[model samples]
Target: MPSFLRWIACRAMLAACLAGIAASARAGCEPLTEDGHDYVACRFDPRSDALSLYWRGADGMPLATTERLADAVAATGRKLVFAMNAGMYDTALAPIGLYVENGRMLHRANLRNGAGNFHLKPNGVFYFGDGKAGVMETGRFLKARLNPAFATQSGPMLVIDGQIHPKLQPDGASEKVRNGVGVRDDGTVVFAISTEPVSFYAFARLFRDRLGTQNALFLDGSISTLYAPPLPPVGGWRSLGPMLGVTAGP
Candidate 1:
């Protein structure tokens, strides 16, 4: 099919998936397309879905892989239905920026200027608590002075206040499998991963345009991975830093 045709078809699919979706949403993924790029979006609500973040296991080591996380949660009589790499990490697999899990601040916000995607100015944080979620630029988030139950800091925000990152090119040459998160106006959290390699601008637009999120944060590239099965590999992921997922009790 022509690229435009495919894009149209995928938009229709996304609309159908979102129709009637609310706090009742389950951990299910749907195919989406934006400006000819293919993506898979999985949505859930912390109000009803067991949306949460994970880092260490019972043994106090990073749970690194989705497969391993699934095993660990299962042992606790829970079902892990959704997961994705949460943010960039160091060689030791520690989140490079602020990381809060279960209302506990495990790491502090990173404000030092440095190289790489994480240092992209206006990097933001995705946070949730009390059944509410939001995406905010790291600076603004700090000024807000609100503490959330769970939050992860990631770089080069895809969208801010409804605008794409000022630095990304609409048709940039760089392309790779990418994933990110956004919060819809209704406080519903959406996680997405590009099915095919895509540019940063394209991926960012997927959240703002098609997904209707006011703000979005780029989680990672190439290493981006979504744990929605039956979907494609998404990308290679292991030794990942903080991770987010949805679970259900047995």
Candidate 2:
């Protein structure tokens, strides 16, 4: 081939490669409804989208709201794209179970059983590092002894190894606003929250059936909320504990 023709072909290939990368990195949220309940579902590529866990601010207090987190991230020259309350917490806005951020372990994993969702047996941790993400039962996580760059321990895994939690009932009377995270087969991280109250069984189905995730961990309920852009901010009276957020790439 002529030199001129070879140069044009090389440029075309480079352009195509760049386009594929952009498509894989795209992230956003959308409204969804299931089982008569409303929800907001956001999908992101863990390998590309910038995912981070945040707790305390520079003032040594939890960044309770999305606005505060956004400002903090903005100061670092990156825009906060979306955020959601992650894991269960105590009255003082501290994570009830294991919480790790940027290699720092703020809280230790709780293995005992007690009241509330956090203590729900078989509670799991959602963790990510080295361009990979996953959800594992707390017991399994402890056994593996893997150290992640970011992690949050939350409970009563909605979907465990492709099976729904044994305690969840199809017609359970309990229902409340809930949010959770799941990793798809292709390494996409999906964050979903019920805009309206929903039962644990129903919410679990959303991850296993709708999202096709084999493992999903419930983040929180009642006060579960999300902060996705373009849609008005969602907030609650209770202050958040640990938060998971996605920020604009550098």
Worst 10 residues of 2 by lDDT: 19-28
Q: What is the C-alpha RMSD of each candidate to the true structure, in Å?
A: 9.7, 3.7
List lDDT for all candidates, in order: 0.86, 0.87
Q: Residue 6 error for model 2, in Å?
A: 19
Question: Model 2 Cα displacement at 9 (Å)?
Answer: 17
lDDT for each residue of candidate 2 in 213-237, tens digit (9 for 90 to 100): 9999999998887887776655553
Measured against the true structure, the TM-scores of the candidates, in listed sequence, are 0.88, 0.89
Residue pairs in candidate 1 whose N, alpha carbon or C atoms collide under 3 angstroms: none
Clashes of 1: 0
